[model samples]
Target chain A: MLIKKGAEANLYLKEWHGRKVILKHRIPKKYRLKIIDEQIRQYRTLHEPQLMHKAKQAGVPTPTIFMVDTANTTIIMEYIEGKQVKLILNELTKKERISLCKKIGRLIGKLHRNGIIHGDLTTSNMILTPTGKIFFLDFGLGEFSKELEAMGVDLHLMKRALQSTHFKFADECFKAVLNGYMETFGQETEKVLEKIREIERRGRYIAERKEKP
Target chain B: MEYCLGIESTADDFSVGIASFEGEILANIIDAFISETGGIHPREAAQHHSQVAGKVLAEAFKKAKIKPKEIKVVAFSQGPGLGPCLRTGATVARALASYLGVPLVGVNHCVAHIEIGKLITGAKDPVTLYVSGGNTIVSAFDAGRYRVFGETLDIAVGNCLDVFARTAGLRQREGMPFGAIIEKLAEKGSRFVPLPYSVKGMDLSFSGLLTAAIELLKREEYSLEDIAFSLQETVFAMLTEVTERALAHTEKKEVLLTGGVAANKRLQEMLRRIAEEHNARFCVVPKQYALDNGAMIAWTGVLAYKHGQTVPIERSFVKLRWRLDEVDVPWVKE
Candidate 1:
């Protein structure tokens, strides 16, 4: 059965070796040249599964890659049965939400510590399983970037995601997330957080400059 | 019905418009300072605005069949634009408001785009994709304000296209800017040259893509039409992706496209398909209002006037960096 049809890929439910799985196929875009489209789909399909594995190794939960059909640009991964955190984040009690934020923070810290950047770090990319474990999904845009700039952009993206979708508790939730991040990386996280501030400052400066008549 | 006059001198366009409180546009007169060269020169554009200010005002008054004394309020674009250009418009607006003994409203150019878009297309509470030579932002109204969900991290999409056109020796088509010149050629090209597609989460950066496209021209690696095609496809795809994400996040029922760049057929097609995929109504303002014009300012000014959102003369100075989200839209509901 077809599940979700995203801009980059389509999600389908299928059975793989007697186990429920999600078949994520990167759809070929008609607007792109066929060869370039094929290359991009192939590259992303190959990289996403590898990133998922690395993320799992770094103490974050990710779907098990059952199989990868590079020819078709498809990945059959273990079906994760859970609610997207964005859908239920507001429903959670304040304390539970803060705890979830901390979990998110630590997971991000682990990813950053391993020099992996989740390109799309929104709450929608997170799944809350039955056991309350947080699983990061959709590493399609993820890459190995050890640069503090990339790490800062990642945290900044997450912070912005909270501010946009969860503005009510964004400040507190981001604080909790930072608390967890600082706890995991300690002093090392300081520079990355400072990078975020620099990024914000840069944005402010640009906006200010553009504002000048 | 009370009428408001809106003066827009945000960039190269000096326009004056009159509208009723109920959103009826009476006059929308504009005098654009088209640059013969690649890009606009700020001081020259300002001088052009100052020169055409009187004639445009007279034409607007004549078209609207109303004298200056009949206008109840005067609104001018406060900012997110060029400084000298904004100052020229502000000076004209403040003098008119003072002469006519009317209230003044300092309108955010970005918010005015959204507001006029809503007024024209009848899209209530849309996730707005405001793209132009100056801005690339995805916004939605929430919590009594239009919150920016995503924006360009560097140069705007239109600027990227304009610069590419200039480097490629493309000529501006009648009624279309240099970017549209690229779009017209792109329609015939079947090949897509590979260009950088930069999307940082919800935000995007186009300088890399712009540089890559220009470099491709220097390399002589691809046909001009092919490169143009590729650039439009890649850049519009980035915009469409960010807009789709904002739509999903906001779950808004409507999508509105505004700004000068929204006139591109490919962009409209891309955004319309995404809006359809999400089961949201898609709306684009008529081309006249879509591009920078006085009517949007006039209509938005009416909205502000109804809510007592006017600015005092002393504090009505132009704000070059006024953020759309910073404006409290009292007229809009939660």
Candidate 2:
């Protein structure tokens, strides 16, 4: 069954090796130069599964990759049966939302600790199973970056996501994420968290320049 | 019906507009200062505005056929623009309001673009991709104001293209801008010279792409046409990705493109495709309203007046650094 036709990729639900799996195929953009399109598709298709496996190994709950076809630019990954956290966040009790944010915070701390940055960090990119386990999705934009700037940007994206979607609960949700982050990666977590504030301040400064009267 | 007079002097363009309370544009007279060279010079543009303000305002009133005393309110582009140009406009607006005994309103230039796009295109509560020479922001109406979800970190998209066109020695044709010349040249390009694509999370940075394109031109390793194609492809792709992300995040049913850069056909097509994929209605403001114009300011001023929003002469100072989110939009209810 066709799930979605995104800008760069098409997602489908299918059966692989007698087991249910999700297939992500990088769609070819007709407007792009042919050779360059193929190169980008091939590179991302191969790199995404690797990032997924790396994140899972670093204690982040992510769908397991079953098979990959670089020639076709597709990946058949474990089918995660659950609801998108984005849809369920508002229905959850305040306590549950906080608890869930803490778990997500731990997952992110692990990813950052392993030098992985999820380029797009939104609740919509996560799935929560009936068993209450969270699985991260869509590593197409993910990369390995240990730089403080990358890490800071990652957290900033998450904060923005929360603020935009769950404005009423953004503050509490972000604080829960921070609490969980500090508990897991207490050693260097302060520096990275501080970097988030610095990034935010810089963004505000750019938005309102002092020179402009 | 009450009428509002709006003055816009935010950049190289100085325009005076008159609009009825019902969103009908009566007159929009604009005079743009085209720099003989490349980019806009602030002082020169301001000087040009101060020199032509009277002519433009008089022309607007003549076209609208409305006496200055009959106007109910006066509006001006307040901030998020060149300081000197904005001050010139504010001065004219305050004087007009005081002379005509009308209320004075201060408008946010960015919000005016969105509002005018909405007024002209009938896109209610749209996810807006406001791309201009000085601004690049993807925003949606959330809470009571248009909240920015993604933006350019360094330079706006138009500036990037304009600078690249200048470096490539591309001149403006009869009436088209340098960027338009590059767009026409890109249509004949088949090769894509590789350029750096910098999308930091939801925000995009075009400085790297601009620098790389300039270097490619200096290297002469590829055709300038090919480089222009690559620049547009890379930059537009980045913009499309961010706009799509905002649409998906906001779940808005409509996509609206506004501002000067919205005139690019390639950009409009890319955004239309993305909107179609997401099952959203895609609409671009008409070409006349797409570029910087006084009609947008006039229409938005009418809306602001209906909401009982006005700036007192004492507090009507120009704010060059106003963020779109900083404005209180009582006209929109969450």
Residue A195 alpha-carbon offset, candidate 1, angstroms? 3.1
True contacts kept of each: 0.24, 0.22
Which TM-score does chain B of candidate 1 obtain?
0.98
Give per-residue CA lDDT, model 1, range A31-51, as digits (tens): 445666687789889999999
- Which numbered prediction scores highest in DockQ against the true structure? 1
lDDT of 1: 0.87
Which run of 10 residues does model 2 chain B get worst, by summed lDDT?
A: B166-175
Model 2 C-alpha lDDT per residue in residues B1-334, reported as the tens digit of each score: 7898989999989999899998899998989888645788888999999999999999998999988877998999997888888898889999889998899988989899999888889998899999888899988988888887887766888889999888777666336887688788888887877777677657877887899899999998888888888888888887887888788667789999988788888888988988887899999998678777788788889889889898889999898778887777889867
- What tens-digit string does per-residue lDDT give for candidate 2 at A93-190? 99999999999988888898898988778898999999999999877777899998888888878887887778779889999988887776668887
Best by TM-score: 1
